[model samples]
Target: MKRSNIRIIGVPEQQEEEQGLENLFEEIISENFPEVGKKKVTQAQRVPKKMNPQRPTPRHIILTMANVQDKERILKAARERWKVTYKGSPIRLSNDFSTETHLTRKQWMEIYKVMQSKGLNPRILYPARLSLKIEGEIRRFTDKKRLREFISTKPAMQERLKGLV
Candidate 1:
């Protein structure tokens, strides 16, 4: 159900209400994803602020796309583009994930960063899987223990990721 949903961050509070979220979404599409042209949004609303109410950053906008394909396209465009902005101000787009899924993904971030610094191409797959390219083959790891076990065989890789694993 949440697959087609995305969260928009950094848009100021009440900005969507002035012109409407649907219009803002359309503008964002047109601005950052000209190829996408126009797409439909099934639902659009601002979620409650996650941090202190006094903070300057506004509440996140939850956008349910008309279909999962549209969501994927938008995300792909966001990735290819250096940055996604609305009216010159910067904004961020990300998949709307459940708390568990988000936390699970966070667990792999340290290792991911380490691998990235080592010049290894690392990608985090959907639902908390880590992918790394060693030599010419790509390895996918769902958990840290399994990743550690596999890295143990590779002395160089094991050495590179000693304490992290």
Candidate 2:
């Protein structure tokens, strides 16, 4: 008997085999799952939506007198008890009722004390003044007219205002 020698052939190149496997896998995925590819394509092509900026709105304010007093006492107290300062210099009260500036807190306190000592109510010594300034988001309601209206309309509010008075 004679012995025979045989040579074995190598499989196809690994790179080519790998590429073929990848192509087969992609074809299988596309055929079996079309929605996945569509979703990926749609997501890739989407653009974000634009948003609009907001504008701030203007607010309304109301004010009214908070107290009433006899004009004579206010004048007298302003003349005799209060001191007005302007530009670091003391202002003098003339007979014509002209002064460089308004009275100070200390002056107002002195006038109040004088009025209290004379057996007169402090509220009756000055005129009522109202001031409004927009601070922020908070709404501060200090309208005397609205307060009076509320007091007139609501018995509870009327009782509360009377207690304050």
| Candidate 1 segments exceeding 4 Å error | 52-56, 98-100, 109-127, 131-139, 151-165
Write down the lDDT of every candidate, Cα atoms only: 0.89, 0.30
Candidate 1, residues 22-106: lDDT per residue as tens digits?
8989988898899987889999999864788677678899999989999998898998896999889999999999888989999
The C-alpha RMSD in Å for every predicted model, in order, reads 3.9, 39.7
Could you tell me the TM-score of candidate 1?
0.67
Write down the TM-score for model 2. 0.16
Clashes of each: 0, 0
Error of 2 at 139 (Å): 8.2
Considering every candidate listed, which one attains the maximal TM-score? 1
In model 2, the runs with Cα more than 4 Å from the true position are 1-142, 163-165
Model number with the top lDDT: 1
The TM-scores, one per candidate, come to: 0.67, 0.16
> Scored by Cα lDDT, where does model 2 land?
0.30
Model 1 weakest lDDT span, ten residues long: 48-57
Residue 83 deviation, candidate 1, in Å? 3.3
